[model samples]
Target: METELDIEEESDDAVLGSYEEPVRLVDDAAAEILILWATNQPVVWKQNFFVRQTSLSFSLDACGQIFTIIQSPSAMVKPGVTGAVLWDSGVVLAKFLEHAVDTKRLHLLGKKVVELGSGCGLVGCVAALLGASVILTDLPDRLKLLKKNVDANVGIPVTTRGYVKVLELTWGDELDPHFINPFPDFVVGSDVIYSEDAVVDLLQTLSQLSGSHTTIFLAGELRNEAVLEFFLEAALEEFQIGCIDQKRWHPEYRSCRVALFVLVKKSLSCM
Candidate 1:
């Protein structure tokens, strides 16, 4: 029988992803800062009860180099602005990719990857750094920030092995020819399943983009059991699903708050 957390276990780092030495921001409002490990880059924010942050940065260890991804944060008060802010699920997924590639467990070299809901573009950037030609997609409104980050981190000096591009992709809409002509080797998303109403649309897009050979990896925060369960039930009909236990994740990056999954076409898995 298929299970959500079905992957085999592997040893991983013990610490939650480490941070570098704290660096204070220029403004007096700067209170607490968390630095990414390896590169002592600081992520600073105001000292308020509800911190209002402008930008967030993370340093990841991958490709024998430290890669930094900078993100612009948007307030939730805005009607449709969740994509601009960084989320824990995205971080966990990005770090997992880094660790998996670094450890020689998941080979991304020369593969084509598509990241759904590429908010802040973290996972997509890391994939490029690991040698996967990647397309980062989201709504048209989210493209500007996604493109900016892709150009900054996945360009020449930082990622020469692979390439990254940004395109607008809505959940239920028709996919562009680029996504269908050469189906992606892997499709990925972090926190893409949040609402019950969007599940069918997301499944539609996933079905159209994947082939028998395509693999899908998704990470999400377990915010609502009903929504997640609904997605899982709907997805299982078309794909073979397996869950990656926290033990199999990057030691320091694994979290009970987030869940990671692996999916493959049912036809391929049944063979």
Candidate 2:
């Protein structure tokens, strides 16, 4: 008893249900070259490939002010070159900080903030924009690009407020007088927890930089459960740890595979 209209409707429904989104394969190297050309930045030829700049935009608030960061291209397996590029966890943490400030959950206005492993300084730039006096730190080789990005994005000091500085910090090294004399009110790290061999050194550095009143925020990709567990196990000795709820972050930035943690020095009473 089915009419032609009924049959056509059924066919349409089946077609729609079976439809799949198309996937586009991209040549990463070629795309980097194109991006470099469009941005008018000089390109370097290395090992039969082009090294170029990558531009990223981060929103500072609901008012639509954005921070732009320029960074060199990076390779996943390249030795000693990870800090030249941007990473997803950095973007997520930047967005999370913006969200937190917008909601008044965490106040950064006029606070002293330090960012560890500030690869391209995206998170630190965003923090500076949010009114925190920020110190961006990384290895010696990485400081050049980090400073470039910070200078380009943050610009000159504004009326003695929201200043940004770049410093070299090697994990487990002797504590510098500047880092120890005035502990940062806040310590932040994005995607700095991947290396198992460096965890102890990192913890030592963090302990040296943090105090009872200092708050620490760490955002990292949950790629290896055992590595993360090892960090948490070691960190528990000094810090009281809690994970930020993923639902509280901007929906666009929410990643089930990425986690943000808030840590505070454990009080003797609580320990």
Best by lDDT: 1
Q: Model 1: per-residue lDDT, tens digit, 1-271?
A: 4322222235321111111111111111111111111122212321211112365765556556665666565444677677776777887888888777766667788888999999788888888888888989998888987888788777743445566778899999998898877888889999899898888999999999887557788888665666777787788677765556565678877655666777666665344
Q: Write the per-residue lDDT of candidate 2 for residues 125-243, one digit (tens) a residue.
A: 88888888888999987888788888877876822666788999998998778776777778999888887787899899888887545777888765555677778778877665555
By how many angstroms RMSD does model 2 differ from the true structure? 16.3
CA lDDT, every model vs. true structure: 0.69, 0.66
Cα RMSDs, all models: 11.4, 16.3
For all predicted structures, in order, the TM-scores are 0.76, 0.74
For residue 236, give model 1's deviation from the true position in Å. Answer: 1.0
Error of 2 at 7 (Å): 63
